[model samples]
Target: MNWIWISGVAFLLSFLAAGVLIFFGKELEDLGITGNIYYIILIPLGFSSAAFLAGAMKSYASFTSNESVSYGKLQLTGPIVIFALVVGGGFIMPNFNRKEQFDVKMRIVSNDRPMTTLNEGTVTLYIGKEPKTVNIHDGEVAFYNIPEKYHNRKVRIVPAINSYQLADSNEVLISKNEDYVDIHVTRTKESLSTLVRGSVLDQKNMAVVHALLDFSSGLATCYTDPNGNFSLTVPLPPGEKAQLKVVTDGITRFNEVVTISSTIPIDLRIDKTP
Candidate 1:
């Protein structure tokens, strides 16, 4: 009776899950994003396994109540079969990242006092031996599913701003884990810092200290020290040029377009003339 009750509940839940996924699939298709078949079936697989476990737990109580050994064994065998399938199927699944794939996505951030959000970056994933690139955007990025043949194999995920400094994570063992692998990548300030430094001098070539430097929109500002040396940090948007505005005596001094493509200091000379 317990087995019947658990199985009944499991079947209902699995059925509802399948229906919801199927509904979402149509919506996704309407949105023009490709859908995967596994998305709908995996729910049933998981819930059915859970149902078996529930039955086994209920049957254990029957053991002390004169329940037959054979019946208990039968109850246990159901779960064992599901577990075997989950474990065995990990290696036997023919489809991996091939066609009809799912999205593998993650967020990108910087390790700072308050944590800076990295809006754009790129990562690479190896499905089996095949490598694929995923473009990052607005704090998250994804690579659409891989070739199906690599579905049950060990997958490699790597992130590198430059091809020469690529870093790899331990190969992800994907069996019955899920249809997608979400990965998070963090970049230290050392990896993305751009130091802007220069000496603010006056007409006499003397130091013009305490001069104000502003980036467009006044998003960032820095001031020259007594020695006319100023150091500022402004992360130029990836792959773009930005302007730096300096103000002296309520007048615009230097408004120059600069490119910061590396983790190096950009030098500037600000001299005021009468």
Candidate 2:
């Protein structure tokens, strides 16, 4: 009949009930409140429920602890009913809030294609209407801050990383109280339609066709034709003058920075190192 002992028992029962409701409460409905900030409410509710149960036990004991050890039924009922309500409500509030929520797990699929990483390694993530540019490593990313309010909403995701394009925008429908999303995206190189044609030559005026041409990250093993002439579609990033370095063994590296002023082949001559 000690109120302190009774309060401890109440706390234990409340903890157990909350655990069961959160983990296996599917029979009540898959409220999906297993892991969320809403659970923080249970902390204070547990203490309040235990305190109420303790007070009820003290009041009930006062009626019967007169050595006659007989407490009127009506005296017991009030405390018992209040204890039930307090503990019961504590377990339901989170579920009520969760009834509006769903979870999202997003993984950016790069179609198994290798990503050409730049200095700024980042992409844009669109959650509902909010857009955030998040850094990505290994082409994988995850987010857990979604609220239940975003449930059943249409979400469009796109990668804004430079040198890479999503190929197409990916749209996903947020369905269910828990949504596991696998975003299918094909990371293709951002397109450049312009072509640059040229020839590589040595000091002897010989075709340096086998010369290795380094154009940004995309290397072109440009070997000259029989006439010592080589041409390639330029893959250099646009909006700036691009340079191609001719890397040959032993000889000093030769290169030229040129803008394709015309569609006609721009003749390039790799002069000997001065």
Candidate 3:
């Protein structure tokens, strides 16, 4: 009975945790906790495994004891079974008879003209762990029968074209029904001109000149001028986050992630190196 109570408590706690994750998953994701579908399944399975082990230990102890084994001593099975059923049903019941599908439509344009480069390029759309790739045709492509589970979720669209690069707007929110996404690409030579301007300052509120700024693993790099101003273009679209590393006098002073929001100059302040 004591073991049963312990197992029951463990199950309840796990259930509560899973509930929080399910209900507030998006909020948690914003805070960097990747509460994806896998976590939802893993959490319950992990707790159930622990409960099963506890019950097994109790059975072993009882069998080895001088006291005769009784049916009442096996009560741990009740909560364990119930927990398993509830969890399994919660995940499995949703997929049963779920034939709903969604469609995602994409339109590609290059230099303000409809892109008809089927043989020259392909676009890949990623929803969670699933990736769908389709060749661009007639300036458009459509993905059909996408599982309804991904409705309203965010997706990443990447376009691969010979001598052409995506200009802007990659990540998009998938709609509940038919979704439409627009992508723009430009020639590689014409793409590198989107510049991001910024400045680096030290603890004394003074400009840190000669500071090296690297973005997207050196996809773009520049050093601060005498007045601590720097400008370099990155290969990422707007609204995408990139890793920004700042080195001053050959010593890394600031290393952080930054979101590419706009052309407005970004001001970064760091502690002066000793």
Candidate 4:
């Protein structure tokens, strides 16, 4: 019996055992190794096991040829690290972290009515523990990449209200008695035009244009469409200065400020010109 043959068999068996333990050993109470520790130990066991198995194959191959078998740990390190990130543990961190977190509360009220729940709501933190309440529908809450310090904190949001009723119109009366921002989205206008006149040999320049009715409290986003064609009816927070942002085809086109009023119309034009 060749020692190399015996060693090969032993390594294979040990490797199989380690794999099974990793897959189904969650209840292995007495097996001092568990979780990451189990995997860490199995790492070295796996390498040694392979070395033994390869030693046998080499012993046979070497006698047939002058070539020598060579192995290195460097080859395994990259794969192990990648496996840990994608399979062993990193994937679960987001869900687990959310559950372990303490959340903040945001209160949102709208002018439409005292809705049991808001259509949207968000909190904006300028600094420290203090955060301002912005209506979710105003598009303020869509901001991502909140600093880590503000992560998991809750925001309070409220909508705007109208104070009086119109005499003879289908429009509902706005209740201004409550604290909220007044926001109404109406499609105002749309148009199309050319930025650059294409010659017989040039690419055609076409623009889809739109006009918008924008109103909010503090933030206002205003811009003509890139092609000067389209308009938007974006919700505004209740204040004098507000931020405005636009999205077309899942892309954020622009961000800026403007005074939001019932009188001014926001315009956007998306360029289709190549």
Candidate 5:
């Protein structure tokens, strides 16, 4: 459910409940005198009105902002409050500077397969001089866009990854295991330390970190080379996890499942196993 809609509904319900109690309950009338019914009704109405007005003011402030707000008194939260007020105050403020204030480029590439380089094609929109496009050797579209812009400025092509999705309204039920059991596997090598110095000292059997993926299941099989080496060039499989066994002769064994991602190197070593 949308939080904003939920909040609005909850506020409306509370206001209605307060109104009902004031009108039907004798306790409310007994607490006050005759002709004071107006006061009773006005109090709640004033609260509701103030709440709505504050929300409106906040919304209005959000749209308006000055490069500077000159206020004599500065409180600890004055800047934050001013920011909130400008954002919520329902005003549109323009940024005066236009000299490449901030920018970002999205580069997409198929590391496993061949595709066109992102730099090869004509950038459809306001691509910078050296815009970073997906570095592909084949035919995969790569694009980016400014998340927020002052005007309807069209620039980088927005890719599927940049789009947002709203989940369905139906209640979702999910079950997951809270506890996990470790399995045993073996590996030949391990890194000496998490912060590895320049190179392993005098080690020929040293293994460079490499990832093996089970194509059928799309799970990553990661193990560190007792050699302490890793490769960042490998491509990630489009799967939820990796499934593989780690074992090495004359070395420790670890048979456990670990989450997989291309962003982090697979550096599990049997020697480090406790």
Candidate 6:
């Protein structure tokens, strides 16, 4: 038997199998196979395949050669060498290509000024359902070990503070190499209150006097004045959607969702019940 040829063939087969395993490792993980268990099962299968091929080749060579072949103590040398190389490389190669991790720093600001009063709060960064939260320190917070894939992707940053309307900013773009981000927040007299001023009118466009307006499931409720004008502050920040229900004379007039963007007055028209 040609020992060199057997060794070379076994090495080639083992190398190709290892490459396939590495390529599909992520897919395997998604299929609920963890890395340790995955490699544990696949590596032995690869090694056995290589050893079988080497043994078959050795048998064929022995059958074809007319001369009497002598049995050697190192008969399984080819398969043994391949197993050693595969197992050793599996442990050694990861050190050369470590996954790159990043640290992201965020500075909180309100009205274009760094917030000095906000010394205690948590800032959460979300990429889909995965959230990384950090406590604010000196108006700044940091997230560490952010994966490289999140770079250049859009992420939502939300601040949790008391007696303040923390705006959710989804326009934050995670830069490829940049680590610092600036977030602007809004402060309100109450927790995330939006001043909504609007008018209630009938189908005839006449003022609907004494009509009751409920904002955000009664978070803020009030009645329209004689001029059909109403004003209330709802507990919601800008760009948030809230339900607004209007009632007059024991009849539901208007029930729908509205986006709170500004204090600009909106007109709500409904048909009067006979």
lDDT of 3 by residue, 108-130 (tens): 77774446644557788886565
In candidate 6, residue 204 scores what lDDT?
A: 87
TM-score of each: 0.35, 0.40, 0.33, 0.19, 0.21, 0.35
Clashing pairs in 2: 101-148, 209-223, 209-224
| Model 5 lDDT tens row, 1-274 | 2434544554576567556676754443323332244334434343443444445433222333345764333433323454444343323232233222222332333323233333343222234464333432233332322233312343434222211111222111111221211111111122111211111112333453432322223332333445555332223332234343444443324455544444454444344233
Q: Across residues 217-266, which tens digit of lDDT does each residue of candidate 6 receive? A: 77889999999998877777766787888888788888998888555677
Please list all clashing residue pairs in model 1, or write none if there are none.
Answer: 95-148, 96-148, 96-151, 97-146, 97-147, 98-146, 98-147, 98-148
User: RMSD for each model, in Å, please?
Assistant: 13.8, 11.9, 17.3, 21.9, 24.8, 13.1
Question: Candidate 2 vs candidate 3: which has greater lDDT?
Answer: 3
Please, what is the whole-model Cα lDDT of each candidate in the order they appear?
0.57, 0.55, 0.70, 0.37, 0.34, 0.69
The TM-score between candidate 4 and the true structure equals 0.19
lDDT of 6: 0.69
Question: What tens-digit string does per-residue lDDT give for candidate 4 at 54-138?
Answer: 4533311222323354542233333334334444353355456543222222233334345344444333434336433334443
| Candidate 1 C-alpha lDDT tens digits along 58-164 | 32212222356644433344455565576456335755643554444444434321213444456667764556665555545565544455556777766654312
Worst 10 residues of 2 by lDDT: 28-37
TM-score of 6: 0.35
Whose TM-score is greatest here? 2
| lDDT preference between candidates 4 and 5, better one | 4
- lDDT of candidate 1 vs native? 0.57
Sorted on lDDT, best first, the list reads: 3, 6, 1, 2, 4, 5
Which is superior by lDDT, 2 or 6?
6
